[model samples]
Target chain A: MTPRRILLGAAGAVVVVGVLEAVSRSGLVDETSLPPASTVLKEAGKLAVDREFLVDVGATVREWLLGLLLAVLAAVPLGVLLGSVPLLGTASRALVELCRPVPSVALIPLATLLFSSPAQTNMSLIFYACLWPILVNTLYALRDVDPVAKDTLRAFGSSTPAVLWRVSLPSAAPFIATGVRIAASVALVVLISTELLVGGDNGIGIYLTETQQGGGRTDLMLAGACWAGVLGLLANTALIALERVAFRWHAARVEGIA
Target chain B: MLEISGLGHAYGTHRVLEGIDLKVGEGELVTIVGPSGCGKSTLLRCIAGLVPPTEGKVVLKGAPIDGVPDDLAVVFQDYSRSLLPWLTVRDNVALPLRRRGLGKAERRAQAVKALASVGLEDAAGKYPWQLSGGMQQRVSIARALAYKPTLMLMDEPFGSVDAQTREDLEDLVLQVHRAEGMTILLVTHDIDESVYLGDRVVVLARNPGRVRDELPVTLPAGRDQIGTRADAEFVRLRAEVGRLVRGVVKDSEPPDATDAEDADAEAVATAVEEPAKK
Candidate 1:
């Protein structure tokens, strides 16, 4: 990215915020419903130093990270197995197709009733949401592994496990990384949604629920949502940067394709 | 030494190669040349045990090869796909050295030597994708060299590079073949390449791929691209291999169509389930 691009991005963000601030201040809408951007930003600043808010942020991040990690652990190996074995892949295709589209957010009530702990409920929902992207990406990436690389390894008398470890894994890694980045955002959304519905004690969603319950403090509610959005944005940016650095060759190849 | 006896292959109704028999001596470089889609690659795969021929068996030393032998290596033409893009050139070259029980330091040491042999010593740290197409192919060849296989198979290894790089790579293979005394079987569609690189050139006919003719190269060892190609004998041999590969010898050849059909029938008489695709 160039300095000029960064400058323009900053300017664009300021313009949006200015528009929101102006629209709110103009009294075109009731202040109680859509709090002025300045007032929300002021509350958000206080949130940066508030110990309780910090704990909420930490809890949200922890749940998101844990759920994503578990999903990746379960999905990647299972994806590789199904991807490599034609029989297993064919066997499970119907089941996967049926289960995949049922939204994890819709499962919140079921998960809340089934799991005793709030963490368990949050984790279950987040895990459900994060699994599909990672699994499908891993599966397709493994299938798309270069045949020549596999053949070259085989010609040297390398075993099946050797070829998988050396060729298939490396070839699939960039795709896997992209999947994880997508899963990270999905996990955050699911985590927050689960907490909001289940009424957790320490998460951004909990902060929103509590603020709304405490005589409808609309400023605090908007501020909490702002922090959550910022967190997602920062995470996505970092993950994108990491992908670029870790898989430069894959990045170059993708650019060439585009 | 390698012996292939009456080998035939088919994918359902699609017969790729049929009734092929050839013998290769130890430490000899043989090149197979023919038109496109002649199944020359399939023959190489069969010899390497990467793909099993439907009929007969390939015998390496005294044992019939049921799987790829430990003393075999292959250099494929599509270097962009053959070499792992994530690994450094040194690691790519050293990859086959694993399962040999060599320590990391030893593998790198051998890989460095192989890279130097191909004039890629300075590129050891770069990824295969970072190199030119020709340099990437050299990395593939360097990898095969580092494996130190008793037999090496190359499938049009220079096909995708520029002409100058192709010549350089051809020389690199010849240099390695002579230095290591490894038996090499190269498949090509280029007639001049077959005459230039092989100790003997085997021309194959398309459609039911089978050897049409074989000619021993009498050019002196240590050939150069300029000198050996200009040799009168080289000119004659290339033209001969070219004519044979182009199906020009079909008429003058003895009428063996019935014999070929009989052989094909016997080979497919006990047909069984098709083997899994490699």
Candidate 2:
């Protein structure tokens, strides 16, 4: 990003904060329901070092990572298999279309009944939420592989498996990484939602629940939300950095086109 | 040696090629020239074992072809799409060598040597996209050369480049063909290209694509883009092939004359004999 863009973004954030601060302190909203922006920021800063809060953050991150990893491990191969084999892809189309659109949050009630522990319930919901993006991205990426490249390898006497390994997989990898990055953010959202709804043993969502139940602390609730937003931002930034480093050729091609 | 007889192909009910019979002796260069939609590419694909003909068979050295043969390579018309962009030039040239059961170092060494032959050794470490269109086509040719195939098929290989680059690539093909002494069958719609590069030019008719005629190229084996193309024999053969491709009657022959195929074949044969008789 350019320094000018960074400066503009910071200015936008400050303006938003200033508006929130004014609206809260001017009695436009009830003090108990809407904490001042300064109070929320202070509380968020304190929570950054709060040991109990840190534990909840760690638990949420761990669950998000685990669920996203499982989804990628399961989805990439399944996507490749479906993409390479036309008959199998056609056979599974009905089932995939049916499952892909149902929101994972709506499955929280079923997950709770199916799994014995809170962690299990959250993990299953996270996996379900993260599966489709990675799968669909991989499928489209494989379809988009350069047909001539595949034919060239085949004409050189390369086997089907060799063609897929040498050409299809590498061509699809950048898209698959993009899919995983998208799934990572989705996993975090679902993990926190499940934790809040199911009251997981230790998580940011569970901590937010504690603040609501203990004294209805508006500052603490907003601070918890701020952390969730921060975590998402951090994860996305890290994954984008990784993509740049790993797929320099893809990036160069994209830049050339643009 | 390679032999194809009574070969025919159809995509579902739409017929693409019909009754194609051709032979390529060892160490010979044959060029197939035709108009668009003549299924020249399909015929090449059939011989490469990529597409199965609906009728007849392709025999290579006494064996009926079932799948892509190990001792064959193809230089496609589209160099940009044919070469993998992710790999460096050296890697792309070496990729097919894995089938030869060579180790990494040997593959790299051979790839470098092939690049040098194509005069692209300095660009070995660069990606395919980093090079110009002409340079990329050279890399693809180098890749095919490194494979050391017994039979090499080129499908309109220089159809994309500018005229100057096209000449350079044509000479590169001749250089490699002469140096390696491999059987080469090149297909193109350009009548001049066919006469310029081939030891023999096989012309195909468009509708239900079939072989129209085969004219043996009598030009000197040592050819240059400038000297060879300006030769009298080259001019005569090109015009002859051009007329055959456009399915036009010779200026000396009447337009209303029937039996166009027999008349054209007989006239071309007579024209081919007159020079040798002198």
RMSD per candidate (Å) reads 6.6, 6.6
Model 2: what is its DockQ? Answer: 0.58
| Model 2 agreement with the true structure over B39-157: per-residue lDDT tens digits | 77888889999888999899998889999988999998778889998899999999999999999999999999999999999999999888998999999999999999999999888
Candidate 1 residue lDDT tens string, B1-278: 89999999887777778888899999999998875556777888899898888998899987899989988888987788898888899999998998688999999999999999999999999988788999999999889889988888998787777779888988988898888888999987778888999999988886677888899999998899999989999888877886686563356644332233223222221121011000
- Judge the docking of candidate 1 as incorrect, acceptable, medium or high: medium
Clashes of 1: 0
Model 1 lDDT per residue over A127-149, tens place: 98889999999989999998878
Best by DockQ: 1
Measured over the true interface residues after superposition, the C-alpha RMSD of each candidate is: 1.0, 0.9
lDDT of 2 by residue, A117-231 (tens): 9888888898999899999899889989987799899999999999999999999999999999999988988888888888967999999999998568989999999999999
Q: TM-score per candidate, in order?
A: 0.92, 0.92
